[model samples]
Target: MKCADGGGGGGGGDTEAEDGGGVNVTLTTTTLPS
Candidate 1:
């Protein structure tokens, strides 16, 4: 059960990470211009 839960959570985490990465890139670009 634990292994199954971890696998599911890992997939969700990857999607969140991709979204977070895009936001981070945008923030860094805005900061660099200032």
Candidate 2:
């Protein structure tokens, strides 16, 4: 579950307090480039 928490943080917010869609898109883009 730690990885899930980290994903939210890496996405930008501690949880869904921020725009999840934007964060998800950012994460996807970053993951693809590497």
Candidate number with greatest TM-score: 1
Task: Assess candidate 1 and give its lDDT.
Answer: 0.51
Candidate 2: 10-residue stretch with minimal lDDT: 8-17
The residue ranges of model 1 lying beyond 4 angstroms of the native Cα positions read 18-34
Q: What's each prediction's TM-score?
A: 0.40, 0.35
Q: What lDDT tens digits, residue by residue, belong to model 1 across residues 4-33?
A: 444444455556685565455445544554
Candidate 2 wrong stretches, greater than 4 Å: 1-18
> TM-score of model 1 relative to the true fold?
0.40
Question: Candidate 2, residue 16: CA error in Å?
Answer: 14
